[model samples]
Target: MTSQPSLAKADSNPSSPGEPQSGGTGDTGDGLKAGLKNRHLSMIAIGGVIGAGLFVGSSSGIAAAGPAILISYALVGTMVVLVMRMLGEMAAARPTSGSFSTYADQALGRWAGFSIGWLYWFFWVVVLAVEATAGAVILNGWIPAVPQWGWALIVMVVLTATNLVSVGSYGEFEFWFAGIKVVAIGGFVVIGLLAVFGLLPGSDNPGAGFAHLTDAGGFMPKGAGAILTGVLMVVFSFMGSEIVTLAAGESEDPQRAVTKATNSVIWRIGVFYLGSILVVITLLPWNDKSITEHGSYVAALNSIGIPHAGQVMNVIVLTAVLSCLNSGLYTASRMAFSLGQRGDAPKAFARTNERGVPRAAILGSVVFGFVAVWFNYQWKDTVFDFLLNSSGAVALFVWLMICFTQLRMRGIILREEPEKLVVKMWLFPYLTWVTIAMISFVLVYMLTDETGRKQVLLSLLAAAFVVVFSVVREKVRPRVDA
Candidate 1:
């Protein structure tokens, strides 16, 4: 836990207990610490963008929309880029440890910030449960000595200790976890291109032709409806990308970190996601039997000349799972710590150790994480399904708030600090509103579907639960007089 000066500014005092400590480049002493470096921030910005969802779920998009699934990814990725740009603009200017949550408090209101903070925390903690199970399952497959649940417990405990050491330890761990995924995807793209170009072991198929794409019902298996239908799933793949901005708040150079990350997102969406998926569809038939069973990328590789396809993908998927767990722990614990500082959660969460990491917050998140692991393996059919189905819809809520905060923060910056406009959201107000409307429509649609009904219900219950707690806390002690 190598400590540095608190980044809080003079006017920005320690966040009142249970409130987000305004990370004003001036915070100090046991409250908040700077243990992460520029490289960690940069890699987190880059590596965290590619999530396990892309590794595991995008194949469904491919099957549902076929070749045109690429279009769905493009559409969603574009929106994510625009929304993140808006977030980066505000985050670069203020650069608080709270990230979007703090911005919501300032731009929206204290209540809004509190609600979103807890919701985001809840969302990631759910992910921690899901991801930890995923990592454990892979381990169980190889070393059958430990039952799957046992592997899950081992994973959660190890990561908890890693996070306890220092924020940098988590960063270093994530850097490599993310690095492996990057390498795997990068390798996939290269091999995919080689296969497509008639350069691989089996050169029977021609390179870059339309047959694989258009042959099976012309690239829209279920028609335009399916392309749109796949959006729900495709959009989920982009969820973890925003984690970098959340994490940037703690880095050595907050503003610069935000700018670099925001700028790099365009390429990540392009190359890692769009570019790679494009290669996947182009290399193999959209309706290939391997896809539905073996996963799109590994199946594609297997269809080609690659050996050990399943094990290779297993390694990549495991890396992705670990990366998600690593980032999830970091994101959730910070939100808890931020909430504690803001007076919304227990004050102990805000208590930082000598390394400046929030020890209690990390452990608290891990506790539920282990519980989630239990639910996953024990209640595989019922509890885990409910957890996965119910919580994913909330990601839109968090992204929407980020958009809202940026909309208001734009004016705040223009009036007070023009310099921070270093990273601007393209088409500002117009595109911003479009993304919001689209997000709103998705949420509304979630309520209409029969299967989606429960998801929407649980999601609203969660959000409303968080909002109510925030309001009650405010009533208990009005900050104006406190």
Candidate 2:
């Protein structure tokens, strides 16, 4: 295997004022160019907090837990906040495209890094196909002349070209895409709140009020146990929140970008997730049939006499799907590049073009993504389901690894470079351990349900396969240190 040098030593050496940092805009120690500006980082961070799942998947959570689904979102959101904190502590000190994967290698071992990094890349590539299919469905609806698969191919190719160009191009596309989603959600929340209080003029809002929260079945319709079920339903929706940490590595000021994203995550989750869900439950009773029939967001819009609500929401959802596709491609490729640099992947993946783009890595990820899209078209039930289930639980695994890595990395950072601890994990080992336990509880709880159980078993099988491969690779060709 190629050399796997210690990042601690590399990051410890201060760069001259004239020389750009490893991931900075000028020629990096690694080949990647820093093309992301502060504005791009800010928008990416905000966009990461809002995902397509929030719009598409909240209906089932509300159906299962009644209005108390807010609690499930809060619990999962808090878990994500803690995980991002631990990640931020490491990322701010030593920024890299690898993000938690590299930190795992330094704190745990090569096996951990190789496994998590590849799993993360796997997760995003799968997401690309999933999001591409979703976007295509909407596009095919607007223009029936184009088939769903045709739209999917068009969307995937366009975004792939965007990523292949430069990091700035990717950021620019994401900036506007995310901006539209933010405005849509923000508008929905504001208008919904006004209508709920009987303040909006000329609207049939069913006299919407706080009574909707409890009048149906006293907050939780299916008893308290459903909250756990709701947790299972909503947990995966928060998967994209960590993408900001990975994107920060390519920013002009990675440490500052990391710190800002970490600090703002709380309010971001509160406003985008908890806040919007609160509006939905407040505007319409949890047991309302329209919510399940027309979807949570659309139902709320319909209740307020909004015109063409479905189409409007379709447009918003399409924007979200495209944004996810854009970011997923960028994220998967960067992780692959990082893996190559660490000697965990092919050396070609580490090479860059004149634009400082990892052409090989980007194309590699897109090629797999396109293949997955084909699988979705040709054999969605068999091969596609296997890919989906195997990747379903990786978000939890990544978070759990971050918690473990932070526990060990905190001491290492304190001993080696105490001054660089600009973003410390809250409450140290105590909160970190609590976060770990919560994630473990969620994973264990997944086994109780049929769907969740299938996902866990399949994901574990995939993880074990990768771990075994990593061990064998290490034994045959041990990593060399630079």
Candidate 3:
């Protein structure tokens, strides 16, 4: 066995905020360029809050909790805000492409970093397959000449090439893709609200009014407990909210970008998530048969007399899917690049090309993504089901780790360099602990339901295997000074 490296040395203070640390800047470490502009980061942060899940997966939540699903969304939104605050606090102190994983190395241990890093990478690659397939289905519907799998292949290849070219290319594509989503949803909410207030022009369904919120069985139709069930249903939709923090590392000003994204999270969640969902439940009754038949958004549009509502919503949903696929490839590659830098992954993943793009890492991630796409096509129910379930709970795991890491990192920052603490978590250790408890409760709650139970068990199993591998790898690998 190789000698073990001192975790204490790994825990040493990060470099000056301006200087590139192990995982920061394009100097003396990974050659990733600062290609993302302020506008790109702005749109990415705004777009991060809206996911295809909100567009596609919300029907089930409305079906389950009725109008009370609003509470579930608010609860999850609050949790995300708190978690992002903690992450922002750290990222601002010492900006790095590694983001939370690097913080995990400093505050927890190498094993923690290794485990979470790989799990996060696994989650996104799987998501690439999911988003690619989703986009393909929509494209195939629009153009029946191409097979679904052919569309999937074409989408994956195109996005992978965009990422391979430069981080800026990814940002440019996302800027437009996300722009469409933001505009589409924003317009929906405005039109829906106007119709609800009986102010819409040429509208047949005026006075949608607030009655739908309480009329049919009074909000908590399934009972207050259903709110928690709704939480499980809608929680995963919030997955991409943290991608901005990861993307911030590649921007011109990492700390400023991190702080800005962190600060604006609340409003983004409010306007996009809570605001849009409110429009849906209000514009039509939560229990309306059409809500489930045609989806919440489309049903709302149809109620407002919008022609071709299904087709319009499909166009928007397809944009959201493509955006997700683009971001997923970028996120997975960066995480792999970080792991490679720390000697946790193959060294080739750490190398970059002339344009400062992590070509090897991007290709590596896409290769697995392609294999996953194949699995999706070949044995969707058995193999792809396991992949989906095992990666399902990772968002919760990631949030839990952020909460824990913040608790430790706070004191570390104070002891070493207090000024670096620009973005503070509200209520200090108290709110941090509360956030941790809330996440743990959600995990435990997942056990009681059939679908949630499978996701929790399989995700836990996947986590356990990674943790064990990390520990064993630490023992065998040669110890090197940080």
lDDT of each: 0.79, 0.89, 0.88
Q: Is candidate 2 or candidate 3 better by TM-score?
A: 2
Worst 10-residue lDDT window for candidate 2 reads 10-19
Off by over 4 Å in 2: 1-6, 10-25
Question: How well is each residue in 1-482 modelled by candidate 2, as lDDT tens digits?
Answer: 22333556533321222233345436555777878889999999998988899998999999999988999999999999999999999999888888999888888888998999999999999999999999999998999999999999999999999999899999999999999998998998888889989998987896657989999979888999999999999998888777778888778899999999999999989999998999899998898899899999999999999999999999999999999999999999999988887778877787777788889999999999999999999999999999999999999999999999899888778878889999998888899999999999999999999999999999999999999999898888856443
TM-score of each: 0.92, 0.96, 0.95
Query: C-alpha displacement of 19 in model 3, angstroms?
Result: 20
**Local lDDT at 48 for model 3:** 91
Candidate 3 pairs with clashing backbones: none
Instruction: Report the backbone clash tally of model 2.
Output: 0
Relative to the true structure, candidate 1 has a C-alpha RMSD (angstroms) of 4.6
lDDT per residue as tens, model 3, 287-346: 999999999999989998999999999999999999999999999999988787777887
Task: Give the backbone clash total of model 3.
Answer: 0
Question: How displaced is residue 163 in candidate 3, in Å?
Answer: 0.4
